[model samples]
Target: MLSNQIRKYTTGIILIVIVVLISVLLFFRKTQLNPVTGKKQHINLTHQQEIELGLECAPDMAARFGGLYSNTDIKNKVKVIGQKLVAVRQVSKSPYQFDFHILADSQMVNTFSFPGGQIFITRGLLKLLKTDDEIAIILSHEIGHVMGRHTTEKLSGFDILEKFKDSTHVITNYSPNQINSYITDLLKITFDSEEESEADELALKYMVEAGYNPKAFPEILEKLSGKSEIPGAEDFLNRHPVPENRIENLKSTIIKYHKRK
Candidate 1:
């Protein structure tokens, strides 16, 4: 009887393992090609899904900090600046649909973007910038984040999100903390390490290609370093902080691509 029970238990375990393996295989098979990033990605959200998600979350983001900037003219001016930066020939094929907004906050000193081209800048950071060059520098970096599909890649890791959606369970919006994580962690990570280096290089390229000074990015970086909110935000200004070699790498990339104009 004991032997019989052991056999039954082993068979059940094998069945469970097979089911899990099948589930995992199905999950991986859902991976699709990312048009923006130009790679096959494991993201569970479609392009339409990403657009809908960005549109849905945008309202709460604006409302969280007293809504968008009140002045329509200033809003239009900001949009114009962003468009100027994007108009560069190098970015013509970029998938970003830029929507520039100046946030109401007066303390945060950062400009950020979402996976599907949702762009935002705190008034604090905007007030700090002195010229169109600085704004272009910041926007170019944010555009890199959008093009890299950073948040979408991060969300792919949260298997719970994928599983829930896959299971057809109800979906609701994230709370403030969740939003912060996506903005600061997921999106930030894209701008944080190697990805950060890529964005910085892209920013410099975008600047020069736009006929603005190529040095604008590092100059803006120097300015951002002075009034950063987080202690390590200083490190952010320097794309490659740890090895201390990123600056040189950046310089080399700039020189190599200097004739890109």
Candidate 2:
């Protein structure tokens, strides 16, 4: 009887702890500055905290696919192109150090970035592109993720995802198998489709703002869709994939900018 009472108390204490911890997180103090979109955010992290976090993971990130490229020429080329995409652009205004790299891997098609301005690509994705413009699009898309603070937005997502007692928390463990936590990873990726589309729009604006032809946006989308010349694409078609609709948005961006210009 005494042991049963003790077990009940322990369970109750654990539940109380979890509740308090989550409550503290929810009301976690946030700052007023918004760097990426200039809109206020409920983030409790400072820019310095963000920069430190990026640097901390950077080495492992570099080592992801054989410790970055030994090919200076290829690596330099990727950096040059990446710099051009952010060249004289708003993202260039970032005070933290900005660096770009292409991994030595041949089995990945992913392009991703870290908050402190670390951009990465796989040689696999590089070989897939038929033009520098396509490369620009990919890097800029990743950059869009950075400049738009999509990852940061996703961080908030973790907090939100955790609020539901049933949802629980699961993080990806990128160890021997890399995607050991694939389920949570995919769950986190289950963002509102509108965020994805908004990021694409920003990508187009930033690309053209960086002087690459905006057409590269849809062109790469077409290629990714795997049916550029088939009158419709398999990528991003939605339940009813429509490239023309997206193209129209890209086309009107300049006009919208000019109205503000």
Candidate 3:
């Protein structure tokens, strides 16, 4: 009986040591610099891995939003603007392959991007946009998320390998409820307000490079702030810096980047 007890304690000690070792390895492995932001970031996934993950998850994500929008004109417009954003030398140099999608859900006023480069904006958010420049602003902001590799940076802090053992199961096996909950949690994840601010700055730069007015970025944020009392808009608002704060920062960015000498 004593021998069995001793063996059980030894096994427990071995498991604890293994867990600690894995944690240490993950910490050390994650200290690479972000290509776009030029900041040291902890991201476990490679650009290729992030792209594959986004591609695998894209179909399921669209399904959750009641599938893709049926309007070819709107769809084509988003694709064109997204491509223009990528055409900017700064964005074009990145490793991600950006793709834009318009979600059919008209009640959710939000825009989001998966790691790598799959960006989606709901029709509800599209309805709020008053010009092509507004669309450019939104898509470029998402492009910033992709370029910043924010999603994988979030995943790096967790036991990503354990959570996505097969990786393929991230899209294939999870139930709709499970996927929704997982994505909701991910969307809630943030990298301080600095990251959002940086994305805004990037959006401004990209919009200007694409020949859209940087002022439109701030205009859309103001519009969203006015409509914040709407139910589903919380996803966009809560996850971002307050619109007033963003507008203030954006003014500084516009002066620094967009002002004529």
Candidate 4:
């Protein structure tokens, strides 16, 4: 009886290991070519699906920030700058359609983009921007996020993470907290900083192509770095890259861009 029990336990472990290996392999196997970046990436959603998801979530996102900004001229200006960036060949040929919006929130200095191309800048962040080109810097960076397909890649990551978590839980019978800790330690992913750097690099290229001043890159980073809301060292693991590192990376990328020109 003891021998049979041991055999059953060994077989269960083998099955779980096979399931985990297959899951990881399947996750890595899912790939699509990113049009703008010209690199292959793992993504679970089609361009149309990403666009639909963005459009569906945008209204709620704006509402959370007290809806869109009310100034017509400001709205038009932001839209035009975004259009100029999108018109750059690298961006123009991409599958995403870009739309820019200004949020009414004047206290939060933030800019972000959704999966497809729904980009937003809070009024507080806009107020700090001193020029149209500065605006372009922010918009282009968000454009980079969209073009990079970071959101869908994240979605894919989560999907695989859930599967792995389920498989492990079945094998170990770990408590919820233990499983959470196990997963966190198993994959302490730090892709955000890399993605931020990529976006900054893309922004530099797009700005130069679109005829925006690359000088504004550092200027805006400097201004943003001074903001109280910018992530500090303690927030490193939880938030986006610290502004100081981003400024340094931006400077190096700008130098590279100038050399290319």
Model 2 pairs in collision: 237-241
Q: Where does candidate 4 clash, by residue pair? A: none
Which is the leading candidate under lDDT? 3
Clashes of 2: 1
What lDDT would candidate 1 get against the real structure? 0.65
- lDDT of candidates 1 onward, in order: 0.65, 0.60, 0.78, 0.73
- Candidate 1 clashes between residue pairs 3 or more apart in a chain or in different chains: none
What's the candidate order when arranged by decreasing TM-score?
Answer: 3, 4, 1, 2
Q: What lDDT tens digits, residue by residue, belong to model 3 across residues 1-261? A: 999999999999999999999988767665678867888886666677777667767887898899999999989999998999999999898888899999999999888898889999999889888789889989998888778777677765554324543233223354555556546656677555778887887888888888988776776777677544655776677666554776888888788885563
Off by over 4 Å in 1: 1-24, 35-40, 87-96, 159-191, 226-243
lDDT of 4 by residue, 107-183 (tens): 77777677779898888778877789989988998898888887567765563234432231222233545434433
For model 3, the stretches where C-alpha displacement exceeds 4 angstroms are 1-26, 158-184, 227-231
Top of the candidates by TM-score: 3
lDDT, ranked from best to worst: 3, 4, 1, 2
The regions of model 2 sitting more than 4 angstroms off are: 1-28, 31-36, 157-191, 228-248, 251-261
- Per-residue lDDT tens digits of candidate 1, residues 125-241? 777667777777778877776666666776767633454355333345656665554444443442456667766767776777776665555545544555434433443344323
* Shift in Å, residue 111, candidate 2: 0.8
